[model samples]
Target: MTHITVDLPETVFSALRKTPDEFAQEMRVAAAIKWYELGQISQSKAAEIAGLSRAEFINALFRYQVSPCQYTEAELARELSDAD
Candidate 1:
């Protein structure tokens, strides 16, 4: 894995000191979920970015109330047709 450094405000770092790793992990998960919600990335890519396996990421999405499914209009139409 490539290592990158992020500079956080002293106050933010101080607050994160109690559980820095957990804080960072939560932030990554939130960012990944937000990106996926905005259709900016696929579920697998978002999961990778969140440092979670696909199933774990999907579960996280449910825990966070973020839907993991993407449904386009055409896809919805196809589903409706298949139901007929």
Candidate 2:
């Protein structure tokens, strides 16, 4: 595993009420979710990046208020029509 280091003010942890470890975990998940939302990465790739299982990542989507589906309206319509 590769390790990345970032520097932040000590107050940042207290502001978020998280320990450094917890903050690190949250940062990873936040980045993964944002990237997934932006369509820069697939859900599975985001989950892997966040160190979460696929199911857990889907649940995290709800917590982050991001849609788990990556489909556009047109794609969804096509899929529905194909299913019929």
Candidate 3:
């Protein structure tokens, strides 16, 4: 894997340093979940951003109570009609 370096404020780095890698991983997962919740990104893209497999990301969604599937009102109505 390739490594990339990013510069953050010293205080930010210091705060991040307090947590172990596992904590960082969980934070990434949570951020991905929030992004999905906000309709800011697709589930596949969120999984990639979180450095997790699609299955793992779906699991995180379950853990965070974020639905993997989202639909507009029109789409929901269409689905309901199709069910009849």
TM-score of each: 0.74, 0.94, 0.67
- TM-score, candidate 3, is 0.67
Per-model tally of clashing residue pairs: 0, 0, 0
For candidate 2, write residues 14-55 as lDDT tens digits: 999999999999999999999999999999999999999999
lDDT (tens digit, per residue) of candidate 3 on 1-84: 555454545565466665455656776798888998898999999998789999999998999887888787899999999999
Q: Can you write out model 1's per-residue Cα lDDT over 1-84, one digit (the tens) per residue? A: 887677766677576673666777888999999999899999999999999999999999999898788777899899999999
Where is the poorest 10-residue window by lDDT in model 3? 1-10
Better of 1 and 3 by lDDT: 1
How does model 2 fare in lDDT? Answer: 0.98
Query: lDDT ranking from best to worst?
Result: 2, 1, 3
Measured with C-alpha atoms, the lDDT of residue 67 in candidate 3 is 82
lDDT of each: 0.88, 0.98, 0.82
